[model samples]
Target: MAKAEFDTPQLKGIPVIPHLQPGAMAHSRPFVAKAEHQEPLGFPGELVDDWKTKAIDKMGELLTKYRALPVFLDACVKCGACTDKCHYYLGTADPKNMPVARQDLLRKVYRRYFTFAGKHFPKLVGAVELSEEVIEDWYRYYHQCSECRRCSVYCPYGIDTAEITMAGREILAHIGIGQKYSNEIIGKVHKIGNNLGLPRPALEDTLEGLEEEVEEDLGVKIRYPVDEKGADVLLVTPSADFFAEPHVDGLIGYGKVFHQAGISWTLSSYASEAANFGIFIGNYENMQKVAMRIRQAALDLGVKRIVVGECGHAWRVAYSFWNTLIGPFDFLDPKYPVPQHVCEFTYDLLQKGALKLDKAANDDKVVTFHDSCNVSRGSRMGDFPGGQFVIPREIIKASCNHYVDMAAETIHENTFCCGGGGGLLTDDLTELRVKGAVPRMEALKRVIDEDGVTHMAAICAICKSQFTKVLPFFGMGMDMIISVHQLVGDALVLGAEH
Candidate 1:
């Protein structure tokens, strides 16, 4: 994990917004997708001969299709509220990383080609022609954004920077410059049904191994079933949950919660992934395609309900977009939220007192929660406006003796991203990832100093992975990051055997 060589932002009580550095992160873009990576997602193998025209056509098509695109593009008044809000701009001191300016990369092109003012008086409108230089800028800065929508929270116009970033990425992809990390994951979901590309046979082996491992580690038998037709619930989780650190612990937590609650659930190899990278790349067709696999799995399994595992952006797509993209989901039980979050499910059981929890089991360490950005701003939990924030904390409290929050502004809907979202988690963007995490890391540092907080709990796979990789750069232990459900597994009491 590479730390920033540039003077990284200091962990101060309040972050001092730095002055502009014109091209600080210009060299920090991810690796471009090759022919093999792009074709499956219906993208060109590489940059096409007529890329400029294709890029413009794609932008025009997007503007027409998504009403928000045109609305956001036409909406900004340059109030600069969002200028200081983006973590990238604060961390990298790159003016172009400012949400409004990043939007202008495409907005300017839209003006030059589509608007009368920009067409006749391009210089007056800050518009530019669709040249290679502009395209290069799009490729560079757009990928630097994590699409966490933190700026949208402060924008008076309610402009969503994530959507603009997605549009920019989509335009780049149409020109055959798709990103390797996300495009490859999208392709994997299309072919192998998950990002990790673990086949059904491998998935089965991993789940079984997890079951046995859990029994040994915690002295309890739990079933992480797969492909069990007619099960009451179909567990559709990120493939990373099958075996990633801190993430795998969350996976164990989900299984233990289900075991104690006695909810009949099984994992689906067909729709193993909750993540829909189509939303990441701003490709509605691909997003819908990846989402439909869940619908297919639910029907095939004859399960009455669908429960998604811990994933940040995946939950956003599932909660906000699933119904529109691939929904009705009428075949599944109507009582549930179609695809319910594992957190919501666990929280519900805790509320009902359906399972026993030994909160003292977590007394050894103090805990704090990092609200995954997508869950905070993009979606909800348990039918409330801020249930996304409340439920996770409530669950952690139930399973722990001590808990703390970072800061009033830094939490809930205003939470900073884990710095590795919107497909920027690839190794190519580690510097951006490490530096972008400054605000979040600073918040955590305060809690550690003021409240003696030892562990930070997160629900998103990307959040867990990002913190695990980058925490050490700031002199924090990598293991300081843990899953919310991992706490539940720690304190959850299975039965009266003792």
Candidate 2:
């Protein structure tokens, strides 16, 4: 026999026993297979009987709730026109990753169990009855998706897979497999009024810490107040910003901008976290509970406007749900309304040339942007200026002299995911995480090898963390990831040091 690739492979050390057999992997076997039908994709032993019953019922309820919406009922055409647009499908060549296939994971069940067409003739509509296997598939595939909405950008009908993912997550929660990272954050925010569960004292400490760090870094006596009354702006950021890498830099950037702008802003020790996990769970009550604090904080402080920091999902929630959930933020300028995203806010400043930048500050490196899915695809705010998703390009251009594009095909709406979105930014799903990351890494690596990209600037928190973890697998470096604000902060030419 030919020698193995490795002269001394690690397996070579273990003696082979005649009776020994390789056992099946944990996720290899069907979790719930029928006599004839293949089971859905999911981890074995995760789908318990009691959980299945509750999950089925919850799925039924979601069909009822979602079907009632005009956007759902009137919007979908089932033409399969947009099926080829899914990044996961394109990347992995997995048929189920197709947008149509992914939606059908739930839509088929909805039609079979609830819709009139399925009740009349299920076979005609391809609506099959839900099985234990189907639930397993739901848990597996649905969780595989980041619900990034990148697919929706190319969809002619504008049917968002994110909506389907949300519906599926609601069902998962009923089955008790809801990931602890997001769900637990929601619970903490609901009880303690922040996702970090930073009570009054802890929050005060963080603010003080930020102040000390800011003073040390910039050599300025900057103030970071918790609940200063009658502030001009209420600055809200994700909890990760306070505790994580690159994100903390974004928070510091906000401070420097506010200092220069002569703006009065305060963080609410009450509602510190900008991320609202209610979006993840489809729990409107919890969503409202978590979001109410922002409005209340504004009311209490008598702030004029709420300026959300560099978070994608938080901006989506703030834009889509905040108005309906807790409103008449009528107190905000009528022209601007309740809340505005930091990118848009910063872009506006750049347009007016309000903030000064020294290109030499960022001249040391070449920067290209990763258009965050939630920011570019969800917001539809790219029409502002410069044709492309102007925010990223403009920010990079303004802050640095050496900014470049990631080839035309990969820039703007066609950009790939960092693979840790839709709350998959957890530590457990290592295998799936790397698998999901291949497409993005491939794209970045090509550009890095050919065009000489020195840094990959992005706006989302999960993208930063995910890229940091997975980039090395593709021969990229951890130092490659930097937030948009960090570049801005670095480039700022302060008039006079405080």
225-263, model 1: which lDDT tens digit per residue?
999999999988878788888899889888888888888
Once model 2 is optimally superposed onto the true structure by TM-score, how far is the C-alpha of residue 362 displaced, in angstroms?
A: 0.6
- Give the CA lDDT, 0 to 100, for residue 285 in model 2: 68
Q: Name the candidate that leads on TM-score.
A: 1
In model 2, the clashing pairs are 41-137
lDDT of each: 0.89, 0.70
Candidate 1 at residue 93, lDDT? Answer: 85
Candidate 1's C-alpha lDDT?
Answer: 0.89
